[model samples]
Target: MILFPNAKINLGLDILRRRPDGYHDIETVMIPVPWCDVLEIVPAKGSETTLTVSGRRVDCPPEKNLVMKAYRALAETVELPPVDIFLRKIIPDGAGLGGGSADAAFTLRGLNELFALGLSDSRLAEIAAGLGADCPFFIYNRPMLCTGIGTEFTPAEVSLSGLTIVIVKPPTSVPTAEAYRHTTPSIPQTPIAGIISRPISEWRGRLKNDFEPSVFPAYPSVSEIKEKMEGLGAVYTSMSGSGSSVYGLFDNDILADCLTETFAGSAVFSSKL
Candidate 1:
């Protein structure tokens, strides 16, 4: 089976408090973008499962890849046949695009179909949650208001259908752990879901990402990209998650094209939401 796992951007992220389990409580809106990675799984010839990756180069051993981990997680519950997993990665890693999490979620869905596991979405999501906090969102795969370390989700009534979204990933990485270490979690004055309910134009002043305060100071380039995007006539712009990748939402297609050309050297993607 061939599956294309899509990427997502955080509309607004807020760290509410630190949890007892070493994870932070968060409130955020996660929205899917057209950017995607391709994955294919087919029955292997031998008893051993195998993985081959291509495109944009995954920087880890194949065994440690989330696709492999997804398979292992499922294998523990059900009998499975050997399969060859192929991944073509295009989404930038550690940019808070949820590329890896999408891959893992898609793998669980694919395996259920390929092996006839007959699992429900909730069941699959339960298993996916063990892979990553963001994994469950991809299973639902739509705009969601997320809380509780980003695992809990409710459908968000948001539609960016007429807007152009431009994403840019600078040549730097923001480790999630490091970003969290620099943060001081506190509840937001205005919750992201409430902010989103207002007109997109109003989002400029009310909607905010808590990560920007600490991350922007540490990695000025990411902040600069956000500024450049706003200067280029974006209706709204923000860092997707912790750092490194920034996105601009625009009603003007011409402006989106100009921004794409401006950041050609970096991994830039422009598409309609």
Candidate 2:
């Protein structure tokens, strides 16, 4: 089975509060982007499972990789054939792009199809929630208003139909743990879903990510990229999630290309909405 696991950007994020389960409550609108990673799985000759990776390096053991973890998790419930998983990573890690979670979700969906598991979307989502909060979102792979540690989701009516998106990831990686530690959870003046319903032009001052205050100070380069995107005539620009990756929504393709050219050393991706 071959699948392309795409990346996502947070339209607006608000950390509501800390929960009793040690997970924080959050409200955000997550939208899929064209940037993706290629994943392939084939039945292994032997009983042992294996994983090999190429493209952008993943600095972790194969066993710890989400693709392998997804296979093991499914194997515990249903009989699964041993498979050799190959991942060609393109999305930048620790950029709040949910690349790893997308990989895991796609793996679950791919395995269900590959083995004829016949698992429904809800069932697959239940299993995906165990992998990560953002994993369930990819099962639907549509714009959604996510809450409750990002597991609970409601389909959103938002669209960026004619817009062009430009994403830039700096060399720095922001640790998720550090991001949470530096942030202070609070209620937003306006709900993210509600804000997204308004005109994109209004998003400039109203829509915001709660993590930016804490994250921007630690990494000025990330903030600079956001500023530059705005200066280049982006309709809206914000840090996607915790930190490191910033995206700009432009009115035209020319502006998108201009912005990409401005950032030579960083990883840049431009595509239509």
Candidate 3:
């Protein structure tokens, strides 16, 4: 089975509070983007499943990789044969792009289809939640208002249709632990969904990621990218999640090339919605 696992960006993130389970109750809208990684799974002729990765460095053993965890996830429930998994990782990790989670979700989906598991998306999601908080979102892979530690979702009536999106990732990566440690939880007076439902032109200063205050002072380059994007006439610009990556929504492609050149030191990607 061959699948392309795409990256996602948080439209607006609010870390409400820390839960008893050591997870945070968050409210945000997550939207899929064209940034993607390639995955291929084939039945193995040998006894054990294997994983091989190329492109961006995953920097983990095969057993520790999310794809293997995905395989084990199904193996625990249904009998699964060993398979050879090949992953081409394009999306950079620690950019808060959900690349690894997307790979895991896609693996679960790929395995289910490859083995005729016949599990519904809901069932798959139930299993996915065990792997990561955002994993379930990729099973649906659409715009959603995520709450309850980001596992629960309600369809978001948000659209970036006819817009260009540019994502820039700097070398600096803010650890998830660090981002959360410095963050103070608060309930927004205005619900993010309500703000997102308004005109895109109204999103600036209004739509915000709760992680920005902590991440910006730590990684100034990431902040610079957001500022530069805004200077380039983006309708809206914000960090995707946590830290390290910033994306801007533009009304046209006229400035896309220029934006790429301007961020030569960073990894830059541009696509149309």
Candidate 4:
């Protein structure tokens, strides 16, 4: 089985409070981006399990990869043979791009169908949440109004089909824990669903990412990318997730190439998923 798992950008993020469990309580609108990772799984021929990865800048030990974790999770319940899993990485790791979570979600989804596990969407979501907060998002793969550790999600109607998105990743690694340490609970709130329903033009200034303040000061380069995107006439610009990646939305492609050329140190390009 082969599947493509896409990355997501947070349109608006609000950290409501810190929870007793160590994770923060958050509310955000997550939208899918065309940027994705590919996963291929085939039945194992021998007793030993095997996994491989390929693509630009792919990092991570094969045994530690999320795909293998997902495979093992299913294997525990069913007496299955070894499986060969291959991951083609495109999204940058630790950039808040949900690369690992996406791969795990795709594995669960693909394996369920491939092995005829007969797991319902809700059941698969249960497994996904065990892996990570972002894992559940890929199970539905659509715009969502997410809250409470990103597991409690409600579907939202929003599309970026006609918009051009410029994704920029500056050279920085943001630890999720550190990002939360600097996060302030007094985050501005907005009608996220309403804002998403409106035209992209209307989203120019009304929406905001709560993580921006906490992350920008820690990583000045990330802040610079956000400012540059705004300067390029993006209708909306914000940092996704905990930190380390920023994206801008423009109405057309005229400024796309220009921005990429200017931001050479940080990888920049226009994409849609």
Q: What overall lDDT, based on C-alpha atoms, would model 2 receive against the true structure?
A: 0.92
**Residue pair clashes in candidate 1:** none
- The 0-to-1 C-alpha lDDT of every candidate, in the order given, reads 0.91, 0.92, 0.92, 0.81
Give the per-residue Cα lDDT of candidate 3 at 43. Answer: 92
lDDT of 1 by residue, 120-207 (tens): 9998999899999999999989999999989998999999999999899998999999999989988878788888988899999788
* Candidate 4 Cα outliers beyond 4 Å, as residue runs: 57-59, 187-189
Candidate 4 residue lDDT tens string, 34-82: 8878888898777787988888565668877777877777677666677
Model 1: lDDT of residue 49? 95
Model 2, 61-82: lDDT tens digits are 9999988888888898899989
Clashing pairs in 4: 34-272, 34-273
Candidate 3, lDDT over the whole model: 0.92
TM-score per model over all chains: 0.97, 0.97, 0.98, 0.93
Ranking by lDDT: 3, 2, 1, 4
lDDT of 4 at 155: 85
Q: Give the C-alpha miss distance for residue 263 in model 4, angstroms.
A: 1.6
